[model samples]
Target: MKSGINAIIWEDSANKDYGMQNTGLKSPERTRPHHIAVLAYQGLCLFEFATVMEVLGNRPDASATAWYHLDVCSLEGAQVRATGGALVEATGGREALLSADSIIVPGWRLGPVPQEITSALLEAHAGGTRIASVCTGAFVLAAAGLLDGRRATTHWKYAGTLADAAPAATIEPGVLYIDEGNVVTSAGSVAGIDMLLHLMRRDHGVEASNKVARMMVAPPQREGGQAQFIEHTRPLKAAPAIGAVLDAIRRDPAGEHSVSEMALKAHMSTRTFFRRFKAATGHTPLEWILLERLRLAKDMLEYTDLTIDRIAFEAGFGAGDTFRHHFRRIVGASPIAYRRSFQTV
Candidate 1:
């Protein structure tokens, strides 16, 4: 990643403060509960819509004094059709969006957003209501002109379409989510859970977010990025020899498997191995190894009380500084911060 991108990622990971301070919104006061309005529309994405309710709507515990107040709003009167032939009744109307501290737009149908919805979102955003989208819900935000000039993402399948639809926005389909201060966008389906968990972490605290993750039976933090979930041009099965090599690396990522050694093991020249590896995995051999090592390191960080140097050695990074550098560059957070955010104990 470029230094600028890395800086943006780092700020998002490190800064727990929410809202657009530059845009004149006061930082959330923890003593007072925050209000979140989830927009329900015709042909609603049941899964993505439910994710917002499950993550932010649910109260944490009986002892908690302050929690998010969630309202399901709609532009279409009280009744909206959701996926799977279900009808959802709204708790409020577009007016609820105006008073909300945050607004969530779930996966939307790929079509024009109604003028009323667009105007409501624009007015709400201008009032400093933080807005977020899950999956194709980005199209709704894009239509409202919110994502223009912001870094956003969506399902990899629709990334090209989103790019074409909103040329001013930088669509990064490789990451799980992007936190551009007041505007946040997440990738497809389950990635919404991660993005919501991140929002919980920002609004509340790591411990509070971890407690919510535990209640939901989800990971408090995911490793690496969304690149792992994207499909490759060709399956590893197409190159059985390369498959074996990849399997071996997974089994012992700490082992030294240089390009020459891997090529020799696969009974191919180094040049041929590089070409086949890229074709099969959509990443060069070195990039894959680095990602695998980072995954392993993240696991150790979350599950074990290992020191940085120990994790470096166990994850095959050779040195602590090197491990920290790559971890921050690729994972977008320091090892300590990652563990603090994810570790249960």
Candidate 2:
């Protein structure tokens, strides 16, 4: 029924390619290809929209294989202008929402969402279509009340704002993405690539997904639970006194450090040290210590072949079991699993 011309593309030699002349083959025509609908609006993030088009729209040739049929739809099927000063000609409108197997709402500038768009999304979900948002587009889903009581995320800068706006949805601050079966959300920019690759892997298989990734020159996969790149700001102090204590902890994460000892090193009483430390770092002494140790553990896990026990000891956790507990709690995966998910090797 089918034949392989190469590892990446296969066709039926007995017929004309896969789709051609194989009118009798139900599997080739009925399944495999997914109808994906992407939303377009004024002030859309061109990069985010292009990300979806790159992954789901660009294919080998129609005769080689059919993976996805993409419909770029704008409100009311009208022409929309992108933030980058380009115009988009959409193929469909709300009707595409009903026929799509999946819908993606890329990040758009902050504004009030039209009620019609929200209602179409509600209907799509009710019909079992998977809905996803990239970055601030989580706001659109939230406005639709689709992310109610769901653990979702967006860009770190807007996490607090979205949380306050959507009290019913749980806001996860710094993850790359979160897939809740029917509803999926991703963090800013590049994380959208991670989320779409995951969906591709789920729908097709690893080989097909990897083929696409290779074409795009992107990593084959990044787990949804991977931490977003968040820069922790250090407080400005009057002098370098607290800086010395912070430097000591960073220099030796494995060394035993107590608040009292740190206080003594800084020539301050325990109470004063606690107060100033909180002011300097916006975190309690214990919290900062744990955070530093976790950072070290993550580096070792990603770059080295160290065992879990060795990584734990070097990172100051002292025990493999404790390290795993903390890593899972903070990073959402075990050390081995996290490494497996993200390690370039």
| Tens-digit per-residue lDDT, 128-244, candidate 2 | 788899999999999899999888888877887889878999988657777776788888888788878767755666667788898889977553343414544445672477888
- Write candidate 1's Cα lDDT for 65-179 as tens digits: 6468889999987999999999999998877889888899999977989999999999998888889999999999999999898999999889989999899999988777888
Best by lDDT: 1
TM-score of each: 0.64, 0.68
Cα lDDT, model 2, residue 53:
94
**What is candidate 2's CA lDDT for residue 76?**
48
The residue ranges of model 2 lying beyond 4 angstroms of the native Cα positions read 1-29, 60-62, 223-228, 234-284, 292-345
Displacement of residue 112 (Cα, Å) in model 2 is 2.5
For each candidate, the alpha-carbon lDDT, in order, equals 0.81, 0.77
- Candidate number of the best TM-score: 2
Report the Cα lDDT for candidate 2. Answer: 0.77
Record all residue pairs in model 2 with backbone atoms less than 3 Å apart, i.e. clashing. Answer: none
Q: Give the clash count for each candidate.
A: 0, 0
Indicate the TM-score of model 2: 0.68
